[model samples]
Target: MTHAETAGAPAGDVATEQASHGKSSLPLLTLGAIGVVYGDIGTSPIYAFREAMAVRPGVAATETEVLGLLSLIVWALALTVAFKYVFFVTRADNNGEGGTLSLMALARKTFDKPPVWITALGVAGAAMFYGDAMITPAISVLSAVEGLELVAPNMSRWVVPITLVIILGVFFVQRFGTGKVGVVFGPITAVWFLVMGSIGLYHIVQNPFVLWALNPYHGIEFLATHANIAFVVMGAVFLAVTGAEALYVDLGHFGRKPIVLAWFGLVFPCLLLNYFGQGAFVLNVGPENVVSPFFEMHPDWALGPFVALATMATIIASQAVISGVFSLTQQAIALNLLPRMIVQHTSQDQRGQIYMPQINTIIMIMVLIMVVSFGSSTAISSAYGIAVSGIMVVTLALLLVVMRRNWKWPLGGVIAFGLLYLVIDGGFFAVNSAKIVQGGWVPVAVALFVSLLMVSWMTGRNRLAEKTRRDEVPLEFLVENLAKKKPTVVPGTAIFLTSDVEGAPTALLHSLKHYKVLHEQNVILTVRTSTSPRVPDDEKVTIDAYNNLFFRVVVTFGFMEEPNIPKALALARKLGWKFDIMSTSFFLSRRSLKLGQKSGPIRFWQDRLFIRLARNASDATEYFHIPTGRVVEIGTQLII
Candidate 1:
């Protein structure tokens, strides 16, 4: 069934059921919500203070600089978090979901303008996020583990091993799934926040002056007095906003209210206190103590407890990113921006809980390499801010488009907010760009590889599908033959794969040409994968019963998803279509593109490489779950 067919289906229909329930859950939905959604922002304290301090050139950890940086952090939280995300972007959610892609969906729906630029920018942002995701685990865990050296200097050697073990254990637990471990996430994260706030209060009592940093003028004065230092300070301030994107991404899971409450009520206060605490620690103990201000706040006897808490927090942070990777990949699959891969749902009730073996393994390899390559938190920090800042810039750009198209905000208001955001985010991007030569190349390299693969698969799929459409059998010819010749009847339904919206598909033409007959019921199915993850199952399969003879069902998946045609056919059975797997004849057109002619940015070598790769890609039979013997492949030539 096509989307057009399912358009009017009621809420009670199987495909539309999920869409109807989109608004049902109002409370914080799961235990993982706190840890998954808030962990990244919570862990920002580990490196944010250190990076901010590094920004001041030779300036001692004076009360003034500490206050200045703290003021900037407060304002960043207000503008980027409070005003932009909470008040503005949160309302742009597509059916109560948020992300770059979700925002893109809203933009495309509201504006008919060419969205290629929007999508391109979104992809770049998503690609850069991979870098952030990889380094986040490394830095968060490494920074916490390095606290061992603070308690006993000789324990420095144990940092890498301890961090690696924690990281490996965190990822390994993903297979057991979030359902079990998720129960402890919220309480553990809540405790982590309490610990962060308590430590900050301890230092704040010693130096009440740190509270003055809450003022905006101090930040302005610090920047005015030290312009060069201010420019560098962005590299550090970028860390504070590292997980800002999550606020938008996870909006769909817990809804805007719970997330905002989590942030403004719990997360924000704790983060501010911790940052202030770190400032106090620096002012009282000096810069050398900056390495582990977090642990230093604890009593000598409580160092062990602090380390354990920090370790748990770091693991939770990494778990959040691992799950994020799955979500992003799923989005990519649905959007058709990536090749289909195996996607297994971890839990029946939790639609968001998914596990992709390919993505998991790939991330595991990249993360392990990151740990080995940049052994220390400080070293890994160099590669970190660039990706985060770059992505923020992209998000800002998208937000401008959303404000204009969705909210219909006045041009003046849009420009005012957009320019202000651009200045702040763009400055940070420039500061981070300076690190391109200083280890930032790692993410750039990874983004380049992933982007290439994404672009290749997308273009290749488009070209092949277009070629298949151009060479397909005409529907008029089928109609003509049906009237003139006796219609030979075949048993059951014959499902023919098609890439075109009009006329008889090539598979149908080939079937009729070879067998000289059409099945009693013909299903001209076209699987349309969108550019977002998880098409509302309520609109999953659309069926058009044309005179009870021609049936067309279009099944949609996200770019990071695999299509199961047999499963879809089985779903059709529930809708009153009698489809027998053994009796159903599945026809697939296998297009063979000749090496002679091809267009677009794809070179001949790359085309050849893509064809080779696509051929070996999970077989159509396996991917679609069709009976091997019943499925027939028809080869068609393409001069691409």
Candidate 2:
């Protein structure tokens, strides 16, 4: 079972307070949100408008079609992003953190016993996000770099090679951390948005007739009139709202007010103006100019500079998603959705700044493969919207549960609200699913593979825990037997780590069976992962007096936290445990698995995969930051 499956106490006031304390200036936070949270959507204008206009291969977009497409794009932004995410979904945060998994945690906390469907939805959403993660970097960078074809006609061939180099550089710099480089991300993105709005406004003045697209009738009319190609157009139209999920995912980084203000004050208006501007430009210029209208907006002198700016903006967009993937992986490990991997803290002051080599390398490889396979931005754009659309639909489904259960909305209102957004999000999902034949299968395959890996790990761990429980002696039994027959008492403390505090640790049992000695102070240390994002220091350690010589220690950490046994043990002192690192010995169990004789073909293959994953997982001592010299490992054999 996942840690979220077993956790009961809900973290509310403390988590919220921790999230809000020592707040940055509202303006600064707003700027940061614009830079990081809106990067993907901000860069959409570079390709979104061009893609929508180029739906018919040889035909130029007529004034009617331009207005219709623009209207569709406008309403999509207002409804899906502004209405659903900003105004409504942001309110359903889990103790000030928001995401698919965080929403899952919140919804699960609302009920006495969470339904199985909730976990399914959360896992599906997260898996789909990995699909988005891979495609966003490929498409965003390719679209931006493709502008080089406009800067110098002869430079077209270099786009792919240059893009690969830049991408590799971005991944290479990830180990060094983003603290210094991240400082300029907000200012640069801020300028990009302003440029977008300015260029868009200039075009709107040149072709004032394009403003007619703002009418909802145009959008509805376009959809009705273009029945045959509506599905394809809708998928392209969704490219406009690609990065909307970032607003909710990065909620914990910058609070709701900053994000909300950034959206209204800058990002939203700029995006609308840019999209409208692109529409107006397409109408003013003839069909010939539709191919690279964004670059065409600039004069020859500014074309190179504009391309450079767009490249930077695209890189920033890619950076945001990459960091988001890292964050999500940390949450997955803590929730027990995946096995433990090495997580390195990149910043001392910023807890969220972490680096996972395994994830980084894997994403780099996948992204590079995507870039090479698709070759061009327009080709890869065919694969972009499907995963994001799936995520949006899943988010709305999970939000329905949150509305009724957590928000306590009346049944009628909840149903009405859910049904409305469901149609909108579901429509996007349906249309995008049509792109699967045109290279969209890449993300679908990635999502399915990740989902299978996650489910396998969770299932295998649960079965392993069950087997361990059956094989091990109960903690009470061990304590009672030790009380009756005293063993040679060692001088110092021995802390045996275990998942089940009620049962004797395998390491502890082995020590008694082999060396035949017990420490003066025996601690049954159990590390628990909470459903919330960050646990307060005061609530980190909970101690129970099991007996005179033995005690139980449960160190509770939020999923976002990196576990450190020594630091948590230091916190134990505040709760009356005199924890001394030098004199303490940490004991851990190392399991060597053997396939079960009763397993069938499918079960046997899954067991094999799980065992390989277990073998590759980071050691408990390293993952928990236990001192190496003071640790002891006991080996044991187990059958799946």
Candidate 3:
């Protein structure tokens, strides 16, 4: 679970950026929100309604079954996106950050001793998101390109190659960043939504009675009577709200007011109009001839341009999913749930416009595999909803924990909210689970593999920390011993970094044992990552004197704050230390980890994984933004 930044806590870069974004102009942010936040759900009409009706082929869909599916889709949009995300989940932000991990951070803080199971839920949710990330680009692009069949039936043979080319192009441009093309996103997405509404309205007017599906009775009646068929159909219907969780994850970028306004004013109405329009078309004309109601709505003259526009829209949707995965990876690194990857800040002005090459490449590779394997959107669609449902079910379960423990709502209120959301989320999950033997196994296996790594990393870190803490000697004891046997004092300042604030740093002790010398002014620096988002500059550092040559410094940062040791040292002038970067040496420990024969809590294989993870983690000099020329690394071997 993620934690918030606290006063005097160690922090990183995301908090300050989120703070600035939280204060952006409402109308401008609202425009940007439509492109990024609504991309996933906006593209749903492309395959959602078509998939639902096509789930049970051979048997023609009766008008009642069609209305039932329509009712199900419409209500799912309202409850999942409009109510669950924009209304409830968005309010649980930790200083303008929201996600399964972010909410997991908030939910765990209510009690002194956090429930261990809560952390598992957060990790699993993150894993499921990664699974969704892998499939979204493949399926979205494939569905868009499939529109080619309408323009030219023989051109269908080239769909896979065309989709691959487009996927590669999207991943190839990640290094250049999205700022150059982001301006056009808002305009194009806006146009796409308007067209969706217009096409949907054109058909809806032809079958004016189709509006009856908007009433809850149609959905309730369908579910109450058609239990068996409804149960199976829920899997396909679940796709209608697949990107609902993304709204909360990206909530910090545009702020709540703008996102809410964009949803209520534009995204919501347009989506409903288009969904109802697709249903109207299906009901007016029998469902047998309609492979995709979405493409079928357009006349022959508009087919080519519509396919081109769709390809553009789906690409934007894929871009948003890719960007969201990068953001999640950042949060996971800060929370120490994953190893530090090379994070590239793309835009000079907006930190939110950052990218990760490692993750982007990984996702792109996975997308290509999926496109090659499935060969078409219909086959790929079978693998889609399971991951999304898994994530949603887990998020809602965590929300129940947040509502009761953090919100301080009464038990009755909590139970009502939990049951309501859970039933909706749980029902979807159960139905989707039935697809496991079918193509659904792909995402489930992916999520499980990721969860294995995440859980093992956290477990291994705790074990290593405990073993290291036992070997730590108090700073006061080291100082007193040094006074009795004072070594030759060096001319420059020495800063030793350690997680154990109370003890002498292992690097510092090693430096004295080998070199037999001490710096004129020594500082034991303990950099902390706090539970909040941003820490005040004044509260960033605390200095305490041990003796003439020995000093202890504690630097705390918020989870969203950047952990820049050099910047913090420059600000150390207040504590009577001469801040000269040229004369200072930074001491850091490089632990060479190996698996132990004797095991305690973790499995034998887990220790090996952790050792491998620690071995390959990003260097402290680079991660903390410390100078390389003045840095000293002390090697320590640990088996855990």
The most accurate candidate by TM-score is: 2
Candidate 1 lDDT tens digits, 333-376: 55655665667778877667888787888787778888888998
Q: Between candidates 1 and 2, which one is better according to lDDT?
A: 2
What TM-score do all the candidates reach, one by one?
A: 0.90, 0.98, 0.95
- Model 2 lDDT at residue 528: 87
Off by over 4 Å in 3: 1-19, 57-59, 574-576, 599-602
lDDT of 2 by residue, 118-236 (tens): 88888999999999999999998999999999878899899999999999998989998877778899999999999989988999989988889889899999989998888888988
- Against the true structure, candidate 1 has what lDDT? 0.74
TM-score of 2: 0.98
**Which residue ranges in model 1 land beyond 4 Å of their true spot?**
1-31, 288-290, 529-541, 545-548, 556-582, 591-594, 597-602, 621-630, 635-639
Q: Quickly count the clashes in candidate 1.
A: 24
Q: What is the C-alpha local distance difference test score of each model?
A: 0.74, 0.87, 0.83
The TM-score that candidate 3 achieves is 0.95
Kindly give the stretch of ten consecutive residues in candidate 3 with the minimal lDDT sum.
1-10
Which of candidates 1 and 2 is the stronger one according to TM-score? 2
Candidate 2's displacement at residue 519, Å, is 0.3
